[model samples]
Target: MSTRVLVQQLQSLPDGPVTVSGWVETVRDQKKVQFVILRDETGAVQLVNPATRPPAEPVDPSTGSRTAEPQDAAADPAERAKRDEALALTDTISTLTTGTFLTVTGQLKHDERVKLGGVEIKVASLDVAAAALPETPIAADSAMDKRMDWRFLDLRQRRNNLIFRVQTTLEHAMRTWWIERDYIEIHSPKLMSSASESNAELFALEYFGEQTAYLAQSPQFFKQMAQSAGFGKIFEIGDVYRADPSFTSRHATEFTSVDAEISWIDSHEDVARMQEELLSFAIGAVAAKHGAEIEELFGVAVSAPTVPFPRIPLAEARDIVAARGYDIPRTDGDLDPEGERQISAHVKETYGHEFVFITDYPHEIRAFYHMRDDETGLTKSYDLLYNGVEITTGAQREHRVDILMEQAKQKGLDPEHLQFYFDFFRYGVPPHGGFGMGLARVLMLMLGESSIREVTYLFRGPTRLAP
Candidate 1:
């Protein structure tokens, strides 16, 4: 038996007999012919079976034969082989069900009429394989929650298919950019000895017998430790858990964080430039490789943003939104979700761009470690916005032990509680700053996907805990 060739593998094969296998995406049942749209991760293709009505076998009215009459033995193998292949296909279609898994060996035909990539396979034989229950749990038109309940079915859509491809392309571009710049890529421990920044969002669980352990919320302090330890510039793309339960499209209890920090940077502006370059490479890669597919699937055109994405001072952004008739409905010196939307809309209309950075956030809302600007009483901080969603929060951090301690105290946070994290500053460290961006949210916004779950491989949310 030949190995199971994936649908994607068909593209490289010479036009000849080949075997392909995958779950049936569509079943076009016809009296004189049948077709199955089969899909695997790489691509989708059409499987053609020139078979008479299957199962309740069709009668050959002229000959009154229930079975297909045998092709003449003296006929040429090419024509006879085609006849025999079609007959075998007829029988194979007799037992197929919508979600059945199967392997097929057949002649690959490059035909323009077949809509699936303008290709088709004439079946010689196929294994009926595992058939699914007739009543599908969820249909394409099903509601989001119901479709999520049957996620495997929901992922079959081509739009969902292109999302991850774009993700892979983006990640690759980032990795290449990091490698070329000689930045160390590190994977910090998910289970930590102490909180990286604070206990507010940590997932604490009992440790071996006596003490307790916690899941790291961000690689903040540890990445800083590496800065102290003199790795110079380092980055990590890893998962972090949060205990907060704010149910929003952008909030996830657990999520992949894209983090990076560099020593000897002048300020957060330095960090902001690196971030702009990183995302620029990512969006550019996606535009070059998957832009057309993204348009076909998502109904939106994408472009790799040029360097220096629009930057707006928080105060100026406030004035812009306020002038535009939308007051930020909060007192935190920050924009609310609606305000974010309004500001983003203004950026698009004013600058013709999809991303913007709102910078110099007020010190009060930032973490205790964020470096405070004496001139303005604000932190050297920024949030990168895509379409109107906050995807990253970054700032220059206080490296002075005494000032860091004072800031922690002023925040009503306990010094005794954050002893471990504070120690990074106690030891000698370079002036450094970086950003933590949400992985799925970036992909979600980049592809214009409506929900985080749509782009997440296996979404984890307040209610979703299982496959």
Candidate 2:
């Protein structure tokens, strides 16, 4: 009846009686000894038991007597009782299956020779809680889709577990940094009367059996409303929906968006400065806490990004990509995927940085709410790229009601339909800007993973919608 201890705790405790509970990972039943590798959430440990085999005898059918020597009667009562207990324990261990949840009472011994955690446990008794089927559906080399089909089982791998741990540490660090700086956290409603960003990517559903409500593509409108409501700064980590049918490595139907908006910014540069600093703080915290484990598991060294990430205008970035012998194939005036990768390579080679801000996008490719420079006719916006992928979009918003209406009109959006959003500007809001970033994208890049699906807890893509 010893207190149950985690496998991780065995290393710090002195050799003594202890109880450990976890699912069975592996078992090695040898002729003279038995070994069980039990893994709990914290870690795995080795459990040892001396083998006790049953006596081989031919019973006399009528007399209930054995031809072999009757060791049970000849031995002392205490010795017989101990032998019986050992035989039972050995049988129980033999019947144990992989992934069976069990509790074991044992003597914890620290042995230098023990490969796992330099500790071993001499199991005295085991109590099986739940037994698993012998066959497991997934393996280490299973295809990604097959593994995702059994995500619960897939997550049992230690490397997968560390991804979430790193995510938790990253999120907590970001939240702490924001709260310390007096940023208000908000949860904007997901069901909106209209699209939050663009009409093309909205999930409209029937609401109250009367009107239609659209799933928000972003918290853009409400975050802007907060600026008008006099909230100087706000941050939100919440789910956003997109109706995009993209089958790319980074696209998802639903995702967690990490958003931040601050009032009284001079231009998009202010927002970029804040975001870079925020990322630096969060990454530094993660590196300090889990750097060694990340390198061990993911083989990627986690480092805090330097301040003042190199900035290149969108036009200049395209030129840099072209100069590298690649022409952007798209005519949208925005950097295509290849263009982003090329520009990222150039920045890495020239500045030795993994991040760059591509600023001053042409107004054609930006949202209507983004402020445009009167002289340049380009939006005061920037796309933040990390590890050659665009992870965020931030911009100075058009706070003037007149300009907002004209911009909306130019984009073929009815000003009356968006009057509710325009009302925020009518009340005299301060000049503000912010960014929305994909949480999974950031984690994937941090871990050097190829797809965001590797980092997402439950990725919702076009074709995936189940356990």
Per-candidate TM-scores read 0.91, 0.96
389 Cα displacement, candidate 2 (Å) = 0.5
- lDDT (CA) per prediction: 0.84, 0.93
Q: What is the C-alpha RMSD of each candidate to the true structure, in Å?
A: 3.9, 2.5
RMSD of 1: 3.9
* Candidate 2 lowest-lDDT run of ten: 66-75
Let me know the TM-score candidate 2 reaches against the reference structure: 0.96
In angstroms, the error of model 2 at 222 is 1.1
Error of 2 at 53 (Å): 1.4
Q: What residue runs in model 1 are displaced by over 4 Å at the alpha carbon?
A: 9-12, 52-89
Candidate 1 residue lDDT tens string, 1-467: 98777777777777888888888777887877788887777787888876643235558898988877554653888976666666666866765777777888889987777777767898777886788777788888898888888887888777777777888888889988988999999998888866666667778888997888899888888888898898999999889988877788888888889999988988899999999998888788889998888888788788978878899999999999999898677977789998898999999998988889999888788888899998988899999999999999988888999999999899888788788877787779999999999989988888787789778877777788878
Task: For model 1, state the Cα shift of residue 87 in Å.
Answer: 6.0
